[model samples]
Target: MSDKEQKSAYGLGRAARLNLSLEMLNEMANTGRPMDAVLSSYFRHLQDALERRDRRDLENRVRSVLLHYRRLLWWLKKIKLEPTMRAMLLADMILSENADIPQLEKLCNGARNRMDMLRKEEIAALKRLLGKEINHPDMSDAVQSECPDWAQAGLKKAFGETFTEELAALATKSTSDYRVNTLHTTPEEAQQSLASQGFKTEPCPMSPIGLRQSDAGGPILSETDAFRQGWIEVQDEGSQLVALFAGAKKGMQVVDFCAGAGGKTLAIAAQMQNSGHLVACDVHSKRLSRAKVRLKRAGIVNTQRVLLENTYDKWVKKSRGKFDRVLIDAPCSGTGTWRRNPDSKWSKDETDLSELVALQADIIKSANRLVKSGGRMIYATCSLLPEENEEQIENFLKENDKFTLVKAKTVWEENFETPYPCANEDYLRLSPHTNGCDGFFACVLEKK
Candidate 1:
């Protein structure tokens, strides 16, 4: 048996698990990697020393601490404790986990900490100090929402009356969503295949082929045979909806501009029934190259990958006015995906958002060249900021008199055969609060 299999045969104790969690927490603090990536890398070293249940609980505990990162830091500072990784973890346990002080102290005895070892008195004092202000009305909006100070104003502008509700939703745990590869299997068959392997999934409310894991328990899809056979790909429901909105019917030419890792490329190809000529283009050669395996695994043959030197690569000039549909999944601040990537909340700032807004505008101008007259251009972002979504579309329409905005609801109904949800008329806006998916904004523009 492999080390992982051997270790899985005899799981680690709670203390060992806690130590691993601390190690991951500290690595995240030190390395500035995203929580999921950090956890994935650390888990490999652990070699399944923890059981599935313990493994999930450990991930949840670590994620909870990071998701409530700002609040934990605020509480730590309030108690005059240095906001070290260990301190933040303890604060998370006390305030967020509501961990028993005595048991928490006992747990820490088994967990090893490289710095800032906590004494029993400190843990008790933290419980006392943090408990008193758990819901203190004086808490700042950023701390209370666990949102970054820079993002607060923009989110308020975007969400309006439901701002707090949206932030709470973003701070909550997100489940894995998968889009069934219609090329390989039907949603019904895929569900049956997954159920056979211990996955419990429910149909996604919006996308016909999308499935949502009922809970985090059961086997992760990546390890299942269904995934290896390309029956399912891990994609958010909102993302699947966006690809469907691209409306890439079979035999039509389509461009997935900015097709990072081919998430939407795969979705669009499947929608084409593997018969269309789809070009997956990205500025990063590595990201575009990685899509080869995913494409092959999905049994997709209609798509071709392109490595662009930049958005203005010579390929764009040659391909201008050729594509029937152009999909720009523009890179943005990713504020919409904060629920799945809590660390991003602190990592981005006003300057970064401004830069992304400018970049999106530039990319839209360049990629719009690829859409033929009467063909449509689909612009999308996993961003909550209006500057990146509505404003960019508005500006594009003003500059290019030949192009007019197409109501997203019209395209949504055409693709999904159902009335669009959420409020905006011109754009498809989805949020964790309103759509139970990641926050997404998509609008269609067609040339006259």
Candidate 2:
């Protein structure tokens, strides 16, 4: 059979999947869009045409290439070749997918253009130099970790002795986690329902209501009855922990400040038991609208969506000192989510971090006004940087004497029956290496 006729283990033909993966990568570079968004739009029309297995294969191939994009480029550079998408994809096959080098050589030699074909000398070099290992002893720390130079220093400083371990965790594929919407069904019921539909899941260690797939890249849960029935929502365990830390109770007036797309808002509303008012506020009206749909699907009725012009909007002025709980899931560098969104690392820089830190500072100050005396304000970010996480909280505390830090460990003990895993003193800092969830930092401060 021709190479085009040879099917990959994931179900798509090798040649077809490779070419499509290259196209997707190029589109991501040209458009500056995320892989998921680009994939959705690229395959919108092909949804009906492609089988589920084929789609999964395509997604896996694209994700693998992106996950090791920097390393693949590094290998290509080491071989003294142009770092092209096609070249990187080949390197991914050899390094990540463990494809046979002889087969790759045969396939590339048959390509139409001379640029596409690997020369005999290049093939010999690939055989001599490349191995199953993506990282090399000679590689720079940044290249080995697949992060920018500036970020590598920050991550090293933040993680200290565990820097390599943290990088390994961040490099691995993200686990598929789902938070059981307690408003619709209990964790037991959700797990049972998913299991009945051929989806095997395990309870997340930290979150009581969280379930994760037994394996990576299971069929999309959106097609399952459990998701359709609102029994489960795709949420990281770390994020669910943040909502729990907020301590939203029945009949408590809460504000999900900066509630973009409202993932945490849904969790908070469920904890509120559909009683009292919950305001979901964001600068983007479209995100709030999307969250409205999720709220409805999750059977959350206690929440109302509010669009804000900025942190200092008229709504903030009107809602000052009114909420019992205010959650600011502020914008940041997204360093914590690098595993799930590897391309995001390259998209941002130190300048972006500085800007986000400033914005986060302004946001926390504005949102703090919504917290009534003795009420709690939860500041959260999916960033690993100190400037955006701990530093922001420290500055906020210095500026606002009325608000004092609440130990996350204390809240964890009060809320969860399970023992706290890590020893994060004042803040609830979670990393992929330590928490098996996305890197998240949440700090609770109460108004005196």
Candidate 3:
């Protein structure tokens, strides 16, 4: 067939093609079905249709489609619709089950009404815009090949007009960022060291130790001598800032409670100059094992890992009021890392948040008893939600009279750069969009 004839046979515009791909991805995510089969089926239909597109554009298009699916899933989760309902809708659409159309329409209407009732005005407005586009007869027929009537309706209900643009942006590649391992080398020295391995580094805008990769196609961890020598650690710049706020020093005893995989624990050890006794404690044995391997690779000799399976044990009693510093890097919903781990945005829910808050409160209360008189304890989370960050700390302080807020500005200035405007209350907040780093919240308190 001629090129013009092939293009006509496909009957797909860029927007329509993107919509079809997203519809397929939405089906995969909702049903927990394998994506390869769906993608295969799509390509099979397009076998002679997609003429000689560049490999890069093809990859970018696929990534964009997947990101759009993720964004739609995130919206659905935020509004508290049942995951199964979403899955069923996707299945009905992909399988072309016309009988399921009424059910899909009913769900979409119900979701819209719920949004209106809940005062989600922005989403409601978006819905109205999407409704017009999806309901157009010509577009409706084009979309029907991939999306069931209900699936098309759900897309309008889920994303509105901003959906396509948002997903495309999310699909774009993010840079590989690393925080300098301050214990072994300075940022300048680390940069020089990494250069020997043909890995170029540039300073991150917000973090003193953070470096962004300039080149691609290198196995950074294995190829770099600095990485093997522990001169650099793979950590978000925002996380490094949280560890600096902890203010741990040589010759002081410190505890990192809930130190999962030891990202911040390694930072604390570096700040302590590998001299102070730093105990890395967690409930998970596997995470502790990973931390141990990392600590050894980093040549940190003063740190110890402990598994606190029983918070009420006598070992806990002996540790009470003994440490100079404590860091509760509490478990959280991880909403701030969407740029890096987009999958987490779909996996979490309101019930998960509630459960995490309860666990955080319990852990904090247990750790609080171990802080010595006049010693500092910092509570930190990679969460943007106020309920997990400020509210959790406020509630903890309210219930525990012995501790009071220390000036976060004073501590941060003493250890690191002041990133935000000075506030009366002693707390630090960093958002990915605002701070050019992962979202984080940290508040330091001293026991009276």
TM-score of each: 0.93, 0.92, 0.66
Q: Write model 3 residue lDDT over 140-202, tens digit each, in one string.
A: 321322222222332233235633432233233545678787777899988888777778888
lDDT string for model 1 (1-448, tens) is: 3465436432535655666677788787788888888887766666446457776877887877778788777777777787887777777776765676665656666323222345765765586654553445767876788878778888899988888889889988786899999998999999888989898898998889999888666776788989989999999998998899899999999999999999999999999999969999998988987899899999999999999888788999998899999999999988889888888887778898888888898899899999999999999999998888898988888888989888887888788866688777889999888999998999999998
Q: Given candidate 1, what's the lDDT at residue 240? A: 92
TM-score of 2: 0.92
Residue pairs in candidate 3 whose N, alpha carbon or C atoms collide under 3 angstroms: none
Ranking 1 against 2 by TM-score, winner: 1
In what order do the candidates fall by TM-score, top score first? Answer: 1, 2, 3
Candidate ranking under lDDT, highest first, comes to: 1, 2, 3
- Please, what is the whole-model Cα lDDT of each candidate in the order they appear? 0.83, 0.82, 0.65
User: Would you list the clashing residue pairs of candidate 1?
Assistant: none
Q: Residue 375 error for model 2, in Å?
A: 0.7
Q: Which parts of model 1 have CA positions greater than 4 angstroms off?
A: 1-12, 110-117, 130-134
RMSD of 1: 2.9
Q: Distance from true position, residue 307, model 2, in Å?
A: 0.6
How displaced is residue 166 in candidate 2, in Å?
0.8
Q: Tens-digit lDDT track for model 2 on 227-309?
A: 99998999989889888878899999999998999999999999899889999999998899899899989898889999898
